[model samples]
Target: MIEKAKDLYAQLIHAQELVDNSTRRKVLIDSMRELEASGVNCQSCTGCCCTFISNSMQTDGVQTLELYIYLHDKEMWNDSLISRLNEVIKNNRLDYEISTGQGSSFRRTYTCPFYNSGPKGCSISPESKPFGCLAFNALGKGVSAGENCTSNIEVLKQREDIFENNEQRANVYLKSILSLDWDKLPMPVALLRLHESIGKIL
Candidate 1:
């Protein structure tokens, strides 16, 4: 699975090199909308998935970082949020490495910094969420995947596949554009790296 992921990452990067920034952003936005339209409503779930951190289960770091960059470019990234994210990374000790059989992994448990309990959901716009978050139902099909979810299993699966495909491509694009490796880092750590890189360039 790790080798396959790397191969897909490479393909994604190669494909993005042919596209301009505007086109790439459009693709991301359009893909996000399509995923959102799949009827996987969170309702009052209050970020159930975001509440936990697991070594065995986690979101895609590369895709999350790409969303961060997109928001940063749009001037949506604020100092308060950046500071909060950095704090979360620090508190969780996200910088350390854990070794999986396949490779190094980062294992820690903490509420996702992007989760906003006041809103009972994510602080970021739905369109800007990582593909892993977007595809949760399709990929995991947990308790939330019951009748409460308006999306059918087939639809959810299709959307998940699409999101994953886009994410692989986006990760490749981001790796090439940002000159970063997108293998196995915790989400917060990846975000911190991205934040630092953006700070330097700015």
Candidate 2:
């Protein structure tokens, strides 16, 4: 399992490198426009399946929520927040949901429920999981993936269209996905499914 995890990690790094190349994202909207023409459905891409999410120790609220589930199931959480998260889950409360960041992006009202503000740690999701952990399709060169992100289908497809060459696209795509370091974040609604995924994986 660890070897499998390492392989997954390597794949993520390759994608991250692509994203960091700048040559791919430098074109900005032109790439997006090209992908928009590709007939790919963001909702159906599922590239995120190869991805997982991780957080630093300071993340809280939704971040902690997700972490708690991860810790408890994986037995990774110490005597820290698991008990508290359990209480929250039992009570259907979200006190862990605190306001993070300032703007909608940094402080976007949404965060993963498993995020832990106190320790700032993340409970890693499994690889066979669906795609959010892998990719994000934010507009422009402004967006960046963090850790454990697989690769956004939209972004990967856009790489192909913009490069217009399979070999180059594949290389660039690998770099882009690795650039995120699997740091791509999964949207909230998608996060809601983690509990079930954990159940299946654990």
Candidate 3:
């Protein structure tokens, strides 16, 4: 399933080199560059995605890739993991961690599977380059709902116009992935049984 999904994913991507507005893309790119230079500590905080499950759609570019791979690797998705998945489905949550007040739309590892922790550094660094890594520019108050802001990622303050197009494109890309076999989409965590489910449903 993984290989097939990868191939299909590649094919769909190659089929259309959707040209993003060059000016908007450049602005987003510049924001990314500026954000990197600002030196915010994403590695240290790790944020909600690391522990809390993301209730949001799989649109977050590289995040979806990481999530899909994390769900499949049977080595990680054990019986306990399956049970967790069921609970998430039953509860209609992305996932939650009371230990740290993390909540998700569904129950799952909101933390990226590729995440590697070591004294030296995280296995995946922003510098490594990934498309979906969100550097969301927001209107105001960019911290935990109630937490005091240490400092705002000024990029979040950048022109909202920049993100409007990019976010749309990213979403379109992810949805294309989800559309391949909607009849029997992968259920629960690994999203592995999708084909089987589709087969049975048909």
Candidate 4:
């Protein structure tokens, strides 16, 4: 699984021209920093945005693959990580599909397993973090609670369009291997599914 993931990561890094041009990613991170400077103090506050009470972070296959590779590199992919994912799915009813009335179903909110109360607040890197998480930002000064924060929808759309315009090759490749047919899924569910599929290979 590790080798397979590493190979995929390297392939995508080259294919996506990530090393030469990570402009979109850089812009997203820069925007987040600007928002933080405007008084979005997430560093020292309780992570309300990451809790199941409000979190509904979703990701496509490409994002899930990036996260999987990151976890593997960090040596965070293990039995304990799998257990946490399974527990989150079961405890939060993340597997229950609620119809969206648009020919699709949406999973319930999931508390991010990597939402550590540590200094970083979240354990995942910005590179692998869900776009939904990256786009969400505090709206104004002195806003600690996530209530005042909202997604920079314009930025989110721009980033998403870039991937889609490229035919989402990475996402399609992931689905070919993992049989992940859905366009988007709760982050934990996507990660678990990706992990399960990788475990089956070789």
What C-alpha lDDT values do all the predictions have? 0.53, 0.35, 0.39, 0.75
TM-score of 4: 0.87
Winner of 1 and 4 under lDDT: 4
Off by over 4 Å in 1: 1-41, 53-62, 73-76, 118-120, 137-170, 199-202
Instruction: Give candidate 4's whole-model lDDT.
Output: 0.75
Decreasing lDDT order of the candidates: 4, 1, 3, 2
Candidate 3 has its poorest 10 consecutive residues by lDDT at 181-190
Cα RMSD of predicted structure 1? 8.1
List of clashing residue pairs for candidate 1: 13-172
TM-score of each: 0.58, 0.23, 0.40, 0.87
Q: Residue-wise lDDT of candidate 2 within 31-144, one digit each (tens)?
A: 434544663223233322222223111231223233334445576544444454344333433223344566223312333434433221323552211223323342332223
> Of the candidates shown, which would achieve the greatest lDDT relative to the real structure?
4
lDDT agreement of model 2 with the native: 0.35
Model 3 lDDT on a 0 to 1 scale: 0.39
TM-score leader: 4
Off by over 4 Å in 2: 1-75, 78-81, 87-110, 113-130, 144-202
The digit string of per-residue lDDT tens for model 3 on 1-202 reads 5565455345434553323223323544566556546652243332443333332223343233434444454345456655655664456443332233453233233443344443212334343223333343222233332132222344434534455554445446555555432221113432433333222321
- By TM-score, the better pick of 2 and 3 is 3
